[model samples]
Target: MKSRRPKIVVIGGGTGLPVILSNLRDQDVDITAVVTVADDGGSSGIIRHYVNVVPPGDIRNVMVALAEIPGIYKDLFQYRFETTDDFFAGHAIGNLIIAALSEMKGGIFDAVQELSQLMRVNGHIYPAANEPLELHAQFADGTTLRGEAEITAAHKLIKRVWVETSNHHAQPRAAQPVIDAIMDADQIVLGPGSLFTSILPNLMISSVGKAVRESPAEVVYICNIMTQKGETENFTDADHVRVLNEHLGANFIDTVLVNTGKVPDKYIDYQRWDEMSQPVKHDFQGLRSQGCRVISTDFLQLRDNGAFHNGQEVVHELLNLIGQPRFQKDSRG
Candidate 1:
């Protein structure tokens, strides 16, 4: 009999979670994706506003990431309506499927599970909350922003982010499985995704944060390759770690993965000058001082269209970290 594969839990939302999952699925690890549900833009926003369901963008991405179907099924699900008309324009087919299922099951979580079974996903995916909740941000300048879309457009420095309801309850199903996965996991990975929007949103949930802080699994963070324009305009690798620690509390992560490769000057120029984005400067020494073991490597993958990390190079690096003796050593020392 083959040996049992290690159980892995990835926590985040949007494009990043799916990218990570797509790679991990190939490695035969038992994977569980805990997705953020605070999205309030485009098709997801319309559904949430009208029918009152959890945002489905992140969940849809995870489904596509874990999809075992071949040919048109994948293509069809990912297809988007392109039109100038407001009714159907910009809507994704998968988003509609999730909405339909939610209506049938009368709950988004149950609907997601049902769809996961149908998609023949390698593992599981879940929303961070059951009830649709808005994300609220308090800026440093004393301005408060409501809704995820509005917060992103604030174009100002964010002091902190929280759920709209002070008494908001966690979807019991979401918290229980995630806690169980964390407790039994060999490794727990954070992100190579958006810092504030993707990663921190999940961590801000009270139950999720409590479970992560108490789990024995080695928590690894894959720092982003570039700074997001609106969110992390000038953040460095150390700055990213600092904000995460601040939000999740001290000593949250055990290891940090930083990209050490040279980005092509053309790509850098296109991103910086053209896109108004900047490369994330690696601060290895600064990160090490925070009681986390630092692992640096050339983890960049150039795509056909000149995109970076087109595949799962970052995910492989994360798996390699889990096997290292240094990662096994307790950070509390």
Candidate 2:
């Protein structure tokens, strides 16, 4: 089965990357999760600052998602330290482990590979860059900002965003494995996460973007169900595609999976979903105008009072996209 399974490269970060990968785990497909390493918030930020490594938050989550380990181990890995513990306050067990391993290996990429084996990860989990990456965004108003945390808090319309080394170096490089995975994949998936900080940061890496643009794989964009407040405010699905195409300088996306289900007018809890405000406005015509074959479906599920993509449904569609028709053998002899 492993020899015959279609190889897929799922690219993106934030909470959304895990959802699709967790669902795709049991399928007859080989998965390689290329996660973003640009996060500068919460436990990840603290650990990165002290340890001098890329923030491990997103990579840690991707690891848990792809891991086929014991239930207790998963729980223990996700457990957060209490605020009373001043030294370890708010740090997740896995985040700390990733930080330690990065220090042990002297880089993030090798550290992730080591953990993947220890965790029994069903597929590869690679950080977008082996070093800390600082995200810089230029607003549509000509103003510029740095850091993923800063950009999220800016609440301004962004024109374009790119990645730079945390030490302020202009060049950002993705690992060779990352580039090789995209170039060798049968399908390359983008998104189901923050459009600017999550998905775009990885693509902003010069080499990774080039590989995706040049790869013959079927590129798919999984459009988010809701619009983020400061990030994608009142943005349409086409707006998402437009930014991606502009960044890569080509209409590389071959297909887009869009959620057509109606989110009840008063469905979202403003208190909880403070980041994302409303359902992403659909512009099917515009999506088609971009030369993308759009597959519309009800890929919505409400959990923890927040709206999320129906992982199973999305994974089913992915399997279908790569599934070749089987021919029955004639047994007349």
Candidate 3:
């Protein structure tokens, strides 16, 4: 009998998720991305306003990352209209396609699956919820705000976050396939994105959170290289993990990948990457206190005057973890 490949489920949204997913596609693992549905910004926010479907920017990017199609088609799908293009200005071709497909298919979840197969995606892309979700946050200063954009722009420390429908009443839930993916995974990776907005929104869902907390997989967190101005300003690596643990009400993270690389002072262009504040401080004892195995190394890549994770290096470490005794035993059964 042939041996089954490792099942790795990555949960998060924003630009960071795709960086990791794109690299993981080259590996010999069954990948599933559980994307957050709480985005209310950019072309996605615009589409969400006019359409009743979940935002497609993150889903669209994830699809392209795992897609096995030709470069020209991918480029065509990602093409965005110029500002002078009238009503189509600033809209990515893929975002519009996802919205149109969602309308035809009756849901974003099914639309993504259909598009995934059509695009020849190597793995699964599951939205955290079927419907569009709004992210709500309570700041450390005791103020409240709704919408991911508003929360991030508030520049205040977030106390808690949760998701709700457009009506702002009903609870959000993940589909069974998402839950099954989480429950049966050999490894579950989180972040390289905003701690509160991108990652926590998916976990805020009741069923998704419950499944993650109960899953036997080794939950790894790809901690961001730098702190974000409005989100994680002056945050240490441990602070990031603490926020995640607090929101879930458990120290569920099994391992954390920390970047020890130093970015040159002259390299970062604050004007272009205004959201980035400073390098994340290291707190080895603090991370160990939270019951997380810390893998601190130089996982940095500087490009376009911004700092990002070297996806190739991160994916290599992720694949290495799959061979551990615990993950090996779980995969066999």
State which candidate has the highest lDDT.
Answer: 3
In candidate 3, how many Å is residue 300 off?
Answer: 0.5
Off by over 4 Å in 1: 84-86, 165-173, 268-276, 304-307, 327-330
Model 2, residue 53: distance off in Å is 0.6
Range of the 10 consecutive residues with the lowest summed lDDT in candidate 2: 324-333
Candidate 2 TM-score versus the reference? 0.95
The C-alpha stretches of model 3 lying farther than 4 A from their native spots are 325-333
Which is the winner by TM-score between candidate 1 and candidate 3? 3
Q: Residue 4: error of model 1 in Å?
A: 2.1
| All candidates: TM-score | 0.91, 0.95, 0.97
C-alpha lDDT (0 to 100) for residue 28 of candidate 1: 67
lDDT of 3 by residue, 1-333 (tens): 999999999999999999999999988899999999889899999999998689999999999999999999999999999999999999999999999999999999999999999999999999999999999999988999999999999999888998888886677878899999999998999988999999999999999998998888889999999999889999999999999988888888888999999999889999999998999999999998888888989999999999999999999889988877432223220
Q: Is candidate 2 or candidate 3 better by lDDT?
A: 3
Clashes (backbone N, CA, C under 3 Å), per candidate, total 0, 0, 0
lDDT of 1 by residue, 1-333 (tens): 978888888998756678788989888688988888888888889877787888887888889889899858988888888988578798889988998899999878889989999989898786776656667788889999888788877788888887654245543234477677777888888876777778887777777877777787888888877677667888888888888888877767788878877677766545433323666887777787777888787877655323345346687777776667654434543
lDDT of each: 0.77, 0.89, 0.92
